[model samples]
Target: MQQLAFYQSLWATERRRPGVPERPVSERFDAVKADGYHGMAIDLGAMTLEQARATVPEFARTGLGGLLTAFPQSVDDLRPAIRLAKDIGSPFLIVIGQVMPLSVAGMIPVIREWLALARAEGMPLQFETHRDCITNDLFATVQLLDAIPEMRMAADLSHYVVNREMLYPIRPEYRALISRVLARCDSFQGRVASRNQVQVPIGFPQHAKWVATFLDWWTEGLAGWRGRAGPDDTAIFMCELGPPEYALTDARGDELSDRRQEALQIRAMVEDRWKALGA
Candidate 1:
């Protein structure tokens, strides 16, 4: 059976309560495990290797495995992150780009370098579809894909939906683009988005259409993954509904809804959809 892993945005959690101190890794790990998540994805950009290493045992204690999301400033810096992933026995390293290359040709070398780094370390890495990085603009990623035929991506469509300010009921032309992305996508991320906002909670009336749109995208993306993958391969759809500021708010700065509850709801929805796909 394939497993679903939830990526924890520990930094976002900490940012929500500005005056309060951030929770310890142990606390975060316990909370996620209790919520019934099988695994975790930890973004280690803000921490030192030593600090990240120290936190690994906490994940193990909760019977929860984790993949590290490393922000590598240079190609060579990826090795340490891959080494850390190997130490934790993570199946893959999720790479989030920090630099934006000027041209698709420039981006090709960067992808090659990352692939080499992962291959040299005997680990696997997938570039995340995110904004403000090498794949910042959706069109640029399409261009990069043309240059490198075998590149794999972890699809976080929320970014692209927001990046392009995608209109609802998705235009027919845009649907074709989305289909192309689904075909090549190796993994998925969960978060409802509108053209203007990336992380809206799933229940509010105003957000209903957006929520429905994301679920449809998730369905399409999941089916695509299943078609390409064998029965033994796990498909990871990370429910990364981050805390406030990533989670939207009103003028007063209060959250749109309870994010913890929203995440659990999203998890339930994903499970139901996965079951239907199998049937």
Candidate 2:
């Protein structure tokens, strides 16, 4: 049977509220486990290798599965992260390559090099579709995928929604492009976005249409994964609602909505989609 595992983002636990101290790693791990998450994700994009390494013990203590999202500043920067992920028993590493190349031709070698390195290290790796990285532009990412058919991606389409400033009733061309990306996406992340905003409150009335758009994309992505994935294969759907700037804040620097509640709601939506697949 193909199984769907939901993972919580450790970085999302960050409140970054004024005068509010950060929660300890153990406490975050406890909360995730208690919430019934199958695993947790650590973002090297936001944390250093040492900082990410420090959480290994907590992951073990809680008996939770782990995933690492790496922001490799250089092609070789991914090497250490890969080693650490293997050491911590992470199933795979998600690469958000910070090394930006100016043109599509310029980007191919960089991606190929990193993919080759991951293979050499015997690490399962997926390039993330994100902003401010190698796969920054939607058109560029489509070009890269066409050029490198073997490359797999962790789809975080919120970035594209914001990047393209996509309008509701998305243009046919845009929808087709997203379909292409979803076809090759090996994993998915949950974060709804509108044309102007990167992260919107899912339950907000004004954001309902955007939320519906994201749900539809996720449903299509999950169904595509099931079509190709073998029996006993497990796919991870990450609820990665971010914090602070990635998350909207009011004048007092307080989040407008309950992030934890939002995460749970997104997780449930994905879970329902998975169940509907009968996988």
Q: In model 1, which regions exceed 4 Å deviation? A: 1-9, 12-15, 46-48, 250-252
Best-performing candidate as measured by TM-score: 2
Worst 10 residues of 1 by lDDT: 6-15
Error of 2 at 116 (Å): 0.7
lDDT of 1 by residue, 1-279 (tens): 655455554444443665667787778777878877777776776568888888778766877777777888888888788888977767888788876689888888998888887887888777888887888877888877778777778888899899999988788877888777777787788888889988887887888998888788888888888887876888887778777778778787778788778877887887788889888
Return the clash pairs for model 2, or none. Answer: none
> In candidate 2, which residue ranges exceed 4 Å CA deviation?
none
Best by lDDT: 2
Which residue pairs collide in model 1, if any?
Answer: none
* Backbone clashes in model 2: 0
